[model samples]
Target: MGDERGMTRMLLECSLSDKLCVVREQQYEVIIVPTLLVGIFLILLGVILWLFIRGQRGQDRRPAVRGTAPTPPSRALSGEGAGHGENVCVPLKETSVESFLRATTPDLAKLQVPREQISEDLEKIHNGSCGAIYRAKLNTGDPAKSKSVVLKTLKEPAGLQEVQDFLGRIQFYQHLGKHRNLVQLEGCCTERLPLYMVLEDVAQGDLLSFLWTCRRDVMTMDGLLYDLTEKQVYHIGKQVLLALEFLQEKHLFHGDVAARNIVIQSDLTAKLCGLGLAYEIHARGAISPTRAVPLKWLAPERLLLRPAGIKGDVYGAPPYPEVPPTSILQHLQRGKTMKRPSSCTQTMYSIMKSCWRWNEDNRPSPRELYLRLEAAAKTADDKAVLQVPELVVPELYAAVAGITVESLSYNYSVL
Candidate 1:
């Protein structure tokens, strides 16, 4: 009985010790599992922060893109990169006229007239400072649809600078687009020497010649007498103002504005021409005083060598003057006060006089001049306006005699 009791006690002790070992193992597992889980979470959070910082740095290295459209790739037309390796990029020092026109006017291809397709009439029209003008016919694919065009040829053997200038003018005209008051450019031929610019033919010649014709003859046209009335003057002035306003909006000014530069159509439409000076002014940002401006048509401040602004072209009086060119030059050189034309009506005279203000700021803007002329036109009678005869100087009448409308149609070419 003593041996049995001793063995039972020993077994009880062993069972209690096994129970305690199992409890200790369970406690160690609970503590170690939570600690391992927290370590894994901390490592994952550190990795996420590193990734976010890297993404922010990438964004900072590149410029932000704007605009609704994607930017086009820079194209190198000429110079090193042209016809070179695909990866090469070249920078252009200057923009070529061809490239400029292509960029600004995508329809330039349609406006181009092939040099071989043009046939000239051989008659020279008006000889101006730029070049001689001639009439030509463009051979469209359809014979009936072919139209007569004015060809202004550049004087042969033009220097590189001259050629560039001519091209710049063409591009500017393209930029101006088409308007009834402005002369339209059909196309240009720059492939060969003596580059020719094709323009639309205005049926009636320049206003100066037309006015001269009317003064010479008590002209009967379409069974009615053609006369220059005060109202008619207003009419002509209004059209010119419209043209000026158009140019002003484009940041341009007609440096030379006179009857000689105005082309009149059969329907009495006046279109402004002589864009060479205007283009020069635009390129230079202001008119140079050294230019040979028509003294009689220039305002006093302009004669004194002041830089020309939009108001520079406000004076478009008839070229025929009571004062001789030499005398006018002398008077201007002497700084003598100039007088307004006596032939103009009080209202017309007043308007022109205001344009001649010594201070350019005092002169009326093109828009203001347009409004004043429009108001004057409303008060005048059409029939009475028609009754008044067109006035021209006697010398102009004698000079322009026998130069009929038919003769003018075939004359003059432009470059």
Candidate 2:
């Protein structure tokens, strides 16, 4: 009886000890898991804090508005209804590139080009205020296929503001997407400094230069004689109006529309190019006061700092090509407007006069202009080239333009 009781007591004690051991193991595992979770959570929190701080620093370093006091970030956005006319203002904040990139999701994979793929020459075709432009060939993956592209790059050792604006412009094109009447972005090499915005090469260059070429007795681009008949002028004008219509669809407008901004392909296809001010006006709610627009091209409301309508660019540049730019605003203020050119038909001159109305409201809408152009184009002879008898040189052209030779852009090559 004594042995049985002792065995039972010992077994009971062993069972209790095993249970205790199991409890202790369970407690240890619970403690370890909580501790590991806490450690991981701390690491994640630190990473988030670091990113937040970095972003704050970037915002702090953003440059001030070019010609006015920097406004708060929450400026009013454009509205579709009655507020459309007043949507745009001036002195836009120069938004930073990285933050803008984060805000807008661009397909970097398609846009980012490797530096080695581009083959360029020593000669720069044109020197711009910010950088030099080169005519280069981009090597596609296929050995047989290569693309002729225009590489617009910044000046060496570019300043921070310049770099930011330059990259921001590239993103602006991405936002606009592709349009037949607008220059399309091919790709960009913006990963590092010495940034490049690759654009499809326009064989004939800007329309203004092409117009200057037309003044010569003979001019040809790839054997197509350069001449602008009254009907052909309507055709080109019609295409530009289409681009403006596209902008209207996107709740955007091109403020500085001129011959200088339109680039021509070999087949007389016009693609609108200058979009710096337009980018500012659309991306931000305003534009820089320092943005250079010829007074002749500016709407009256723009000069007076009133809210200009979207139809501002649709009218085409004010017709006083011979007037001194400095004297333009004064003349406009006195109610003087453009005189009709001799080459301008009564219908085209009437169209030009409609754009020159002192009051923005008095001007016809883009649709009206488009209809007129369409009606005129039906009767226009596509093959009949308008011929000019004079051979114009820079000096003679400048004398007629009432501007000094230095004032004229001579980067263009003559035919």
Candidate 3:
């Protein structure tokens, strides 16, 4: 009876110990599960708060413009003052040709021409310092629609400088865009060797050649047979003035503006060519040392190695008017006093004289020149001007260079 009581007491004691261990495990689970869940919730809340704050910061960074779309971050801010100030926010020294092209011509892919489409055996029309210009036929999808184009290639053994110049010219055209008075860039082939820049073929060639031809004979166009009239001179002058006005608005100037640099179409339209000088001005914010600026065409300030500005372009107009060729030589020899052309009307003479003014401040702006030319064109009579014989004595041109007119054709290639 005593042994049975002892065994029953031991069993009850063991059962009580088991119940205590189970209660302890349950209590530990309840506390640990709630602590873990709270930690997870706090982590999630922190992530959400961080994301919301980041979004608010981004929104605050971009201020909206009134009555306009938000300004792009890349656009350059205008300069505060004029007179060779940093007019554009672009870094002049660091602006690579590739970056400039990408920024200005984002859709340049469409302007790329296939190498196979251009003819290999095209005739060279002109040879320039950069390279030779060839007349090529671009094969379009339709045989009849295939058109003639001018291909300007980099010279043989082209080095780093040549490549940079080629790319710079391409960048300039991209910035210039399309205009009626400017030579249109059709396409470019830069992927392959001997990179080519395709341009529209101006059929009648450059104005210098056209003027030479006209001086030799009374050229006929559109059923009108006549010499170059003062009215026609005004017409050409007006077109050039229009181009200059366009360039001025873009903060550019045609550094070399003369008949040789102007391309004449058979339709009597004059388009400006010779962008090499213009490119130099664009890149360096002044003339490049490599450029050989014709002294006769340059203003007195430019000839004296002074800084060139918009006023320098005004000096380019005197050579185009019907002045005696020797007059330029005489004017340069005499020092500062240039005689007005006797053939030109008093109004036209006054304009040319004003362009040659010793004081640049007195010179008219391109816009003013355009207006004056427009007025001259409206009031002038073509019939009386046509009666005067076209006078371009080859001997006079030959005297300066010690070459014949025929030889000048090969020697002189505009800019």
Q: Which candidate has the top score in lDDT?
A: 2
- Give candidate 1's error at residue 57 in angstroms: 55
| Alpha-carbon local distance difference test for all models | 0.64, 0.69, 0.67
When summed lDDT is taken over every stretch of 10 residues in candidate 3, the lowest stretch is 73-82
Candidate 3 per-residue lDDT over residues 1-415, each given as its tens digit: 9999998776556653587657867899999999999999999999999999999998667432111211111110111121122222222222353354455344567778887787655776666566667788898978799889988776433333455677678767878988889899999876534567899988777787677665445433324333678788899888888888788878887877877778888878999888776777788777678667555677767766777766778774344233444355446445454455456678888778778776678889888888888888888867753432555555566555333454344313331
- For candidate 3, the per-residue lDDT at 321 reads 35
Per-residue lDDT for 1-415 in model 2, tens only?
A: 9999998786556753587657877899999999999999999999999999999998777543221222111111011121122223332232354344444335455788887788744235665445666777888887689878887775443344666677778878988999999998998886654567888888878887788777654443345476577777888888888888888888888887877678888888999877877788776788887766666678878867777767677544543656676666677878776666665667777878788777878887777788888898887766666655556576765555444555344344564
Collision count for each candidate, in order: 14, 1, 0
219-291 per-residue lDDT for model 1 (tens digits): 4443434666777878887898899889988888887787767889877889998877788777777655555
Q: List the residue pairs that clash in candidate 2.
A: 91-287
The better-scoring model by TM-score among 2 and 3 is 2
Candidate with the greatest TM-score versus the true structure: 2
Where model 3 places Cα greater than 4 Å from the true spot, the runs are: 1-107, 219-227, 316-342, 385-398, 401-415
Weakest 10 consecutive residues of candidate 2 by summed lDDT: 71-80
What's each prediction's TM-score?
0.63, 0.69, 0.66
Q: Give residue 67's error in model 3 in angstroms.
A: 56
